[model samples]
Target: MDPICTLAVVGAGTAGCVLAARLSEDPNTKVLLIEAGDRMSYFTKIPLTPTVAQQGPYDWSVRTTPQKYSSFGLWNQSQIIPRGKGLGGSGQINFMMHGVGLPKDYERWESLGFKGWSFKDLRPYFVKAFGTASAECDPEMCSADGRCPYSSIRFENKKAASIYILKNHRELDNIFVNKEIVLAAGSVKTPQILMLSGVGPEKLLKKLKIKVIARNEQVGKNLHDHMNTPVYVSIERPISITLSKIFKFNTLWDYVWNRKGLLSFPPMAGVEYFGNSALMLFAMGSASERLMRDLSNYKHEVFRKTFPFHHSSSKEGFIFLATCTQPRSRGTVSLSDISTNTPPLVNPNYLQNGRDVKCIVKALKRIIKIVSSKPFRDIGAKIHWPRPERCQSFWNGSRTSKKIPKPAKTLNKDLVKRTTVAENDKKDRVKMNTGNNFVSDDYLECVVREVAVTGHHAGGTCAGGTVVDHKLRLKSVTGVRIMDASVMPSPTSLYPNSVLVSMAEKAAEIIKHDPAIHHDTLQKTTDRRGGGRKCVKHVRQNGLQADQVYIAQAQVSENKTKDANRCGINSAFYRKKFAEVNTIKTTQQCH
Candidate 1:
């Protein structure tokens, strides 16, 4: 028989690996980690080849439902949301830019009634996850500092969580967790996993003919992501990254043998924060027509006219990628069927909110301001704005009379309904005194509606306060927890990779000390082959007839706290009683 573990973690992504490593520190407690994707391979190991890795077998390459407001430039108006499928998961395929996010980001979560999730509460976890290493010491590495000084990412140790588990804890391989099952399958898929396991919206489960273990209305509700629009700038110098420079024999040799040089470097050169959002600056590198076509999906005519020198092998330009980090718009993940094989319908609903569009436009103006400075002027940098026909009239030097386009009609129908005609007219009244070099706000808004794409930082589907409690446990279910990005109340102001790692570290600590997990009710022998079905069958066959007794005891305990306020009584007390009584009843039933 396979050995029973104290905990079972699903999805061997960054968070799952972290849990497996941290929890397995107890020599007596075993851990079982299950992954749906293929194991790690050499293809995903390189630092600079994230796009290449994304194209490989390990990436889910899931496409979102056609956006009603945005992604007009993308193929079929459906943005591709790439998710890493293998052991290391997205950590292996991401740009390697680690961001812990601003303090306000977590403060917002605390404001939402997530008591222990403030930045102050989560700081230690960040320190614990990143170790003593300094990413800033390495020229190639990039990471956020100031508040999270210890947080760092290394090119060589990119797969730190996965590597730690595979190398350090080989003995805990043959095991299955009897106590608890934790889902860390990322934001996009974790909810699907929960729904498939019969813990989801009751109506949906009934419709699909699946058993309802628990009715969680918020399982797949709060889906949101940072959307970015890349603004390319043409430069006189060949200082930017190019295909010719990247494919050089020496460059490959240096990365493969010495583990240094351009090939080992991260794609994003730098990041600049603007309030809660950010502008990620990186070289366009391979400006070839084919590569540009694949990356942006803008019309061929627009690309040809805007980036005329893109056909050349030289460093054509750099991209000022502006992202709206804290978008108000929310979307969802839902199932059309019961099978886990079927992809969950992901609708990010990018730029659905007017605020998100305005935020991106503000960042674009900032990019223009920066490029106008002496430093950029010295490099002869010029913005290559994509002239989609709709936005062409509002261009800086358009031959036609420049009039501020009616944004209300151009935007989403819902957004249009919310904004009165007076409000739109008021916004249009802002002086079109934008210099001959600058375009009007109307043009930028249209550009945002056309060109924005997913920043690949999707989260908040499961969400803390709704699907799971502050402790990361599923509120409706017992012995199950979610410790991935799905538990985040909102998508952070920056890259969520570092924040997710910190969350995993904190979750490990919570699981280690939580008294509820140690109860006798969870110690029953689990069926290895049948998965959750056997456990559910075991519970049904044994039954929780002692629930009435526990309820009586809970009532008695609650009465002791004047007027028997439900909040006054510790929920843990009821859990302990339920566990003890159920254990006894199960034993009696067996006899």
Candidate 2:
């Protein structure tokens, strides 16, 4: 008899590992945790450098199919989609920026029929999983004494500059939250795990030759990611501290000896503003002014208290931020084949919707305008990678492609004519067409194409209700459950890590209350003969009859083909090839 484990968790990624650790707390439950890779404690918990955590026993280095829309028509040149294969999963490789979704975002989940998943309902779990942030916590936003540590690092040059830019843009003020196994394993591996364990499209499983344990068509569909346009600014002073330069002897020794210096901060740090309903209601217009005052008061308090390093830096550095809240576009993840060892295909269909393009352009223009404002003008910031001319060229190229004639010159003239006509119209036709009122169509499309990158927020594969029920149990299969980012009903606008943790925590509670161990079924096993013991006699007879059929066909075909081959000199080679082909055909027929 095969050994019976109380529970078999297939992945040791963020969600899987968290489930393992939490479920094992019961002690009576013997959890069989199987990781496709290695342990999390294998590497020391060091920040900034992810290279140490990305290879050998830890990573599943999956590459995406060339993106259908990205990088100004250049295909497959976007950054490689790397996901962790081992314990702790992407939490070990991620740039440790702890964040949570807006409260309204979770309320939206409740509206979608996910019971016990609203922000208010899930708040305690988020608090239970994270340690208190050093920054001031809004009683409504942050939690204390959670499983995962949440604190701001001592700001180095890059982090400090980024914070300074974000402070002026008071629109971004959401807190980070997490609980249980904060599923930080990222986009690529989340769906890969779901499909590997038989929780995806039924037709895909048959094509790959995997057993159909569950038939959830939405398992690997509706993938979404946030794309960022890096605000590359050339600082007058040489920037000594960066993730790449942190390994130098001085920096390494300081970290090794005192656990301080540039190595303490995460690889990158920046704030984000949402363009969704949450941001518009609280952080825009006259209401935004009141929030800004509250934020300014909070910053003053933060500076006075424990964090003295929150002050702005004089040296110039780059700023990177998200362009929009909840991109309208979506993509998918699917199995490459039946092989469990092979990585599944990851395809984040970026810029599929025209609104996503407009949102990105509006966000970019807002950042540029903010940086050029009085608060940052004294700092002497300048656009580095995409100079104004490059931005213009990209806009021209996008417009040229959209015109009736595919050529560049014709498109430019057409766009100019269209712009003049739209400006003259009283009803504002241009605003309706471009989605965003501020930016031109050509400019918006260019930003979307050029700045496209993964936000690493992928979900809805093992989606609740539509795929699996709210309990996460497979609708058609017994003794199998899904507990990863794929289980999200929809992608939240916030960082997915905290929400995933809440899911694992809630799933653990659900499992404890019902105990999946006492289910009323046992898995059937196949014997050495490749059939159940009850079918052994019938299977043997079928095999014998199949063998007889193959022999009879071979005897008749071989004699007839050999006799016909005697007509020509090249017939020997033709006969040999024909025989080889016939043999394969006969073997297939035998089954």
Candidate 3:
């Protein structure tokens, strides 16, 4: 006989794991979590191994169709969009940076008619999702040194989140849902899965010859991602992380024996946000020519001379990653073929909006200023110009010559001294001159068009108010709820994982409160324990309707008492409503 569960959650990603763990807290509720991929690879446990893990079976890295306005320097003018495969999903193969997003981000969702999703309502879930891990450290202390002391800057679960959830729950891997299904398959794959399951835009489903269970015009539309471009700087000293340091025997020994060392941390050390732009610092350790080419798909000849095996004598470098937090450009995810084996076509229409280009350019200038700042300069860091041949004309020198003059110190100094205005400020403005300035705005814009790639924070596909209702219920269909990044009404200013986890926590509570799932379960449990008749009689005697009395029949068990409390009724209130239901003597009698 097949095992049956009250709820089934698809895609064991960040939200899926959280939903499974939180929903399964009820002893009466059975939750079956499903993941298309296998368990996460062991290497995923190490913080610095996402790059290596991404190359393995744990990743679902895909290439975008030649971007219309960006990725000109990459091979075929396309960008690589990496998604994680396996239990943890993308969270397993991502840079472990924690970000909660700004309060206004959610307020905007509320403004869009997504009621009960404002920052104030979601704040409790955010604290619950982060848990005690946040309580152990002081944000001010971590910020002082430009490095957080925590071994990993991610949510509490460092391993595949399902592993943590299942280890404590002892649940089944596969089962049928008797009540409802929750889809947490992430933004990219969730839409794909929905389309494949005959629920998506009617036109696309018809073209693919799929049986249409539901026609939603908004399933795969409104796809947006954070776009990032790296500004590389060579470090003159060997103090930064390097391949030599990573391969040292002591490094491995310390990680294996004591679980602390260079390998204990992520390669991308820290991140800071300013206005709508964010700067992520990567310890670009001893970048080889091949590695550089792989990281940023610059022209081969340009990459060869521009960033050699080791740019400086120390063979160490760092990357200032400038990210446009709020991108206006939208893209789409569509099924290329009917078969689930075929990956969906992704068109990240990056930098198509003039605003996105301008945002990234400003961030790039900010990176240049940071590299020239006292802190970076103290480490002997020097900027490396990645002037591909196509963009050579934008620079200061002759377009034909390989020799280029140093960037203008005046421009860097000016940018450093300038106080940035808020995004909403009408006075926010900057004047530009593309003429013979050492590194002009034209050059920065050209670089952005050539090199920017997805920050891997894709979302807003199965958006709220469009595809799903405020409660995350799929509008076009019944018995289905979408609880993941896909339900985000807009792109967040930071990593979406933190927001996704919090959403799941809140979603679980919302699902629990559903009268259908809870009422039926509670009614059956009361009957099985022979307390339903007594409860109904007590309610009738007290001039209360039988349906209004939602009682939990239990005895001397802490878990049962907690479960009863979760029903939204207190012991005193229940006693006042029904004094002698099922012959219970006191409030403690139920426990």
Candidate 4:
């Protein structure tokens, strides 16, 4: 006999996992988790799996429609967008660097008039949920099962699935949504599923012969990603994570038994210089570090990719990942075919904007300077030239399958004389993001359009300002919610896996607390408080918090000093503190 579940959650990735784990805590409420891929296993436990996880059985080898302006490095064709196919989803194949979105990003949602969706409002949820994949339970803090056990092996008996055969797969489970349904599939597939399930723009759904469930004009629109310019540099001392360390017999043995070693190190371990939150002051001509402390949004960053140590000839390397924060380009995921067998058409429209190219080029130049600095030189790290040559498949002629070979000469200077834009105005063009002889605005643009890669932080499809409400419910559909990265209104300032997990944690709480949801059976989330959430309260943002709007409002005041005093309190303190420190240094120098 098949027992009906109180909730049905789609996709068993990060968000899906959290939804299933948290929702099933109540003995009276049954949860069904539907996943397309098999259970998590087979090298998924390893931390440094990004380099090897692709092209394997677990990766959905999805490609974008060839770009006219971006992805120039991929043989002038569509970029290969990798999506994980297993239960863990991208968390299995990702670089494993966890960073949250900036406070301003969440404030943008509040600015758009969506309440209960700010960084302040969400921070408590983040702190309360998702800690150490293993259990971290305090008997006084939680009930016996309040700690969510992350191991798939441990939860084998908990959920049900459809479209895949398992011990609990039901033949008649063609439709879900008895009590409520949540789409935790990522930005890519969530839109695809909604469209295929007949809940998208009416005109498109009609063409695909899908029965219209909801008319949503914004289902798959406003899609964007963190476009990055990656510069690979060789380690001077040659001590970095290598492929041999990841796959060697001892490493395998260590993980199989003890689950500890270099194999356990996250991708953030590769960062040798600055962090992921790099401002473009150096690239944008800020004369002093103190001068640019208040400025942000140019998230050009540096980090390292694991090296293939088996090839001893190759030096251990680090990757400087330059990012264009708040990219202007937007795209859509539409139906190329209605069949589930055919993957959805994902067009990120990478680097379509001229500004995105300039920002990335400037950021790349900053990385070059970082490598040339005394600190990098002291460490023996050098920018590996023509790095695209190392990967033949991703080389210059990738579309044509003819790899671009390395050039023998090296131009190691700090700056090049190329212009920022190919604008009609020659003066503006000359003032572009400068690079060394090896990289010019022209050269970097070509590199950018061709070689720039994604931060894999794709979002904004089911945006809070458009498609979904602040509660993450579909605008046109009832009894449905989205609790994945796909529902993010915009791409965060950081790598977004942590944010996605935080979102799941929050969404679970929101669902459990809503009076209208499961009114008869499910009690308030406070009915039981074994976890850390009992200590935190969801605070609401009552006033305006949009940065641009605040700035604009302050600018309207006739008295400049009064406006500055009112709005720029933090900046004023920083500048004053900087001056005092500089004064002390000057006095010491004179002595």
Judging by lDDT against the true structure, name the best candidate.
1
User: Which residue pairs in model 2 clash with each other?
Assistant: 129-146, 129-147, 130-146, 219-461, 462-486
Which tens-of-lDDT digit does each residue in 75-168 have in candidate 4?
Answer: 3356666676655676666666656667887887677655687898879866654332232112221111111111011011221221111111
List ranges where model 1 is wrong by over 4 Å. 1-3, 133-176, 288-292, 295-309, 402-437, 518-591
For each candidate in turn, the TM-score is 0.75, 0.62, 0.75, 0.67
What residue pairs clash in candidate 3, if any at all? 556-591
lDDT, candidates in the order shown: 0.63, 0.45, 0.62, 0.52
Task: Please tell me which predicted candidate would have the highest TM-score against the true structure.
Answer: 1
Q: What is the number of backbone collisions in each predicted candidate, taken in the order shown?
A: 2, 5, 1, 9
RMSD of each: 14.7, 23.3, 14.6, 18.4
Stronger candidate by TM-score (1 vs 4): 1
Task: Kindly list the per-residue Cα lDDT of model 2 for residues 303-375, writing each as its tens digit.
Answer: 1221121233332355444355677777788877644345567777777787777676666555544555664
Ranking by TM-score: 1, 3, 4, 2
Please provide, for model 3 over 474-544, each residue's C-alpha lDDT reduced to its tens digit, 9 standing for 90 to 100. Answer: 77666778888888878878688767878888898999888877765522323234432211111111111
